[model samples]
Target chain A: MKLYNYFRSSASFRVRIALELKGLRYEYAPVHLARGDHKLPDYAAVSATALVPTLELDGGERLGQSMAIIEYLDETHPEPPLLPSDALGRARVRALAQLVSCDIHPLNNLRVLKYLVRELKVEEEAKNTWYRHWVREGLQAYERELAQLPPSTYSYGPTPSLADCCLVPQVFNGQRFNVDFSGLPRTMAAFDACMKLPAFQQAQPSNCPDNEA
Target chain B: MKLYNYFRSSASFRVRIALELKGLRYEYAPVHLARGDHKLPDYAAVSATALVPTLELDGGERLGQSMAIIEYLDETHPEPPLLPSDALGRARVRALAQLVSCDIHPLNNLRVLKYLVRELKVEEEAKNTWYRHWVREGLQAYERELAQLPPSTYSYGPTPSLADCCLVPQVFNGQRFNVDFSGLPRTMAAFDACMKLPAFQQAQPSNCPDNEA
Candidate 1:
């Protein structure tokens, strides 16, 4: 398998974590988003959306969308299941995952931030304000849900699930933007718990081969 | 079950089509997003995010996120499955669904638009341009993927899979923004095929009891 990844991309970070969690060995094909590599013909052919974290199977089939790829990983390699057994539990985990992936991360992704600066001519300070506003709102909601759920080492259970995979990357991105995590004790606690695991630790952008800084 | 829906919300429309497809009867509780009804104290209690399309089940457990709710429906019902039976096929369907749900819709949704106008003070023309820019880029990618798949009556196969459930509403939104559809014949064809069905037709915003226009 070859994962077309960008170390700093939250979406790519998600697939990398999922692959690590599943203990799958894959070639890392870095498509540097900051350099517009994703828009080049080759990467564009691999991903219709020209997005990062496109997982190419050994048989040469390509997959996009990090959550979908994560679900595929969970399904094909069922041993450390990323989701729960029951339907309601699966829904809970997926909902939590989407809360970060869809609501928060998408709003503050690099492309959207670039759009703010390039297209909207939004100043640096206001753009940071925009990023933090969505992060705060989203993490507050995440914290509320985490507060309601039963206490565990992770966002859901003792073992890390899909929610934790999504949450950890968002927290990484949030910290990069200097979004305060002080208000979200539960979310911060879950992040703390996940970071203790080798999978999450190794999946950090700083640990990736393509890490810029 | 009760669905807290807004007729014009593409996310809510996805759940409505899924519920209709599964032959599940659900009470429609309209959350008028335009009027800030979602921020009310009662709705805040029902959904921590205060987002529409929250499903309150018979057991009084509330589910948020349209994709999560749709997955729950598919799991519990199982008749006329919304996903493919195989893992890879399910992944393909989900990727298509998220291409719209996660990538396209969230960027142009009501709240984002509100932020552009109210906070950023972006003019209406620029805002509409922003909307159509994302729509065109997203739908073009959707078209490329649809063209690769074997010709069928729907996005996947003969059945209305989750991809179709998501595509119809996004097409409706694209049209609302006057996005050019001629370049995306595959997407338009899939939209046409789905709209021919009573489930999709009846789920149109115009057919909803709370539809404003």
Candidate 2:
């Protein structure tokens, strides 16, 4: 298996944490988003959208989208499941994951930021404001949901499930953009707990082979 | 089961289509998004984020996120599955769905549009441009992926899968924004095919109880 990834991509980070948590071994194929490596023909042939975090299986099947790839891994691996056994629990975990992946991250992603700065010519400060705004709104919802559950090591349960896979990355990006975290005690607590685990720590952007700084 | 949904919401439309496809009976509890009904205390108690399309199960278990709700419905229902039988096929379908749900719809949704016009003071025409840009980019990816599959009745196969559930709503929104659909032959074809079905047609915004205009 090989994963075409980028160090700074929150979506790539989500898949990397999932791979590490499941103890899956795969070649690291970095697609440098900053350098436009993903837009090159070699990467474009493998990923239709020229996006990072395309997991190519041993059988030559490729999977795009972080959540989809993570779900595929959980289904095939089975042990240390990323989702809960019960349907309702699974729904909650998935909802939390989508809250970050869909509602927050996509709006502030690299492409969207580029469009804002280049096409719309949005000011730098306003761009950062855009990033922070979405992050705060997303984490606020996540924090509320986490507060509903009893305090645990991870988002939905004691074990780090799919929500943690998503949460840790969003928090990483949030801190980069200097989003306010003071009100999100539970979310920050969950992030801190997940970061303590080797899987998440090893999957950080700074730890990746293509880390710039 | 009861669904708290807003007629014009693409996310709510996705779940409604899924429910119809499964032949399940669900009471439609419309939350008028444009009127700010979702922010009211009653709806907020059900959906912490005050987002449309919150599904309350027979036992009163609440589920949020349209994709998660649809997946939960698939898991418990399981007759005509939303995902393919093969894991790889399932992954493909999910990636296609996320390309729209995460990449396109969230970026141009009512809240984000409101932010652009109200908070950022972006003009209406510029806001529509932003909407069209994201929709075009997202659908370009979708069309590329769909082109890879053998000619079929739906996005993935003869049967309408989860990707179609996501696609039809996106195309509906794209048309509303007057996005250029000329380059997307496959995607438009899939949309046309999907619209032929009663499930897609009946779940449309015009058919909904809360549809204002």
Top candidate on DockQ is 1
Model 2: colliding residue pairs:
none
DockQ for every model comes to 0.87, 0.84
Write model 2 residue lDDT over B42-77, tens digit each, in one string.
Answer: 887898888988999999888999999999999999
RMSD to native, candidate 1: 0.9
Off by over 4 Å in 2: none
| Residue A133 of model 1, lDDT score | 92
Q: What tens-digit string does per-residue lDDT give for candidate 1 at A1-213?
A: 999999999989988898898899999898989999999998877888888889999888899999999999999999799999999999999999999988888888888889989999999999999999999899999988887789888888778999999999998888888988877888888899889989888889999998988
TM-score of chain A of each: 0.98, 0.98
Q: Please state what fraction of the native interface contacts candidate 1 reproduces.
A: 0.82
Chain B TM-score of predicted candidate 2 relative to the true chain B = 0.98
Docking class of 1: high
Per-residue lDDT tens digits for candidate 2, residues A9-71, read 999999999999999998999888888998999988999987878999999988999999999
